[model samples]
Target: MTGAADRVYAHLGKWAPLYVWLLVVLIALGRTFYLSVNVSNSLPGKLFLVHKGAMPQLGDMAAFRHAGGGGYEAGALFLKRVVGVSGSIVTAKDAGAGFRDYFVDGRFVGRAKPVSRSGEPLKPGPDGAIPPGHYYMAADHPDSFDSRYAAVGWVAQRQIVGKAYRIF
Candidate 1:
């Protein structure tokens, strides 16, 4: 080989292990700090950055697995706001059983719709203090299929995939 070609090949060989190690570190970080695309109108942003294995906090955006089949696939991952965290008091007000209003720690969360957009009946979520290792997920959108309905009930800690941050 030419002198320059041999020198270039030698340089690459010297740094080959370092380059491989850098690539491996990058792949690990990519898995830990992952990106998610929000596909629903329940949240404001369309792009989200999730910190995998992070514990979800109240009022934080959380990505969890929806035990689906009601307008969603089985084991669908969802992004929603954590309104009621574990050990938080949740109150449900039902006037003549028309529609129930949910409040967490005296703060208004969201209302449970009597029927879905397709006219399917939706049962209200649990009231009183939230159970341990569970959360009430919801959003401002009235049609959001979250913890307010029986379709997506209480979000357990095991079901939470990660804590999400809206990027866009």
Candidate 2:
């Protein structure tokens, strides 16, 4: 009886480390999946998680693909606040003193400069309401490249990855 018990204990000890390593690997994979499909690192400040499969609302920060990066940021993702949603009116007009003011739903939000860093003219999107299945996004940073420029105009629904929520 004692010999049988000793053999059983030896076998269990040999396999314990293997089982522990397997568990560690499984945990790593799970964490990777969570970060890849549900979190975004494109925004400044803190790491955020995106609400996958949920509808984005105005004032929500969202993660989306860069459609207007002109291949410079191919496959790059961006994070910005949703300023205008479907049926929301968005306009860009002169705000006196050579500055352009951006409006959403008839309320002032921020300014849109008329030139890019390379001295190219930055044209604004057509003034009016945002169409269905589209959105307007912006960032708090003054120099952020966002919907203020025509190149990054209205973002279509398909381009949005998910709505972001600060995690840290």
Clashing pairs in 1: none
> After aligning candidate 2 to the native by TM-score, how far in Å is the CA of 28 from where it should be?
8.3
Which lDDT tens digits does candidate 1 get at residues 118-163? 9877777778778899999998887788887777878889899899
Which stretch of 10 consecutive residues in model 2 shows the poorest summed lDDT?
A: 33-42
TM-score of each: 0.78, 0.68
Model 2 over residues 1-168: C-alpha lDDT tens digits?
999999999998999899898678657655432232322332465666666555589999887777755323654677788989989988778877555888898887678777756776676655588889999988867767778777778888988877777666
- On TM-score, the candidate that comes out on top is 1
Model 1 / residue 25 / CA error / Å: 11
Q: Model 1, stretches more than 4 Å misplaced? A: 1-28, 95-97
Candidate 1 versus truth, CA RMSD in Å, comes to 8.7
In order, candidate lDDTs are 0.85, 0.73
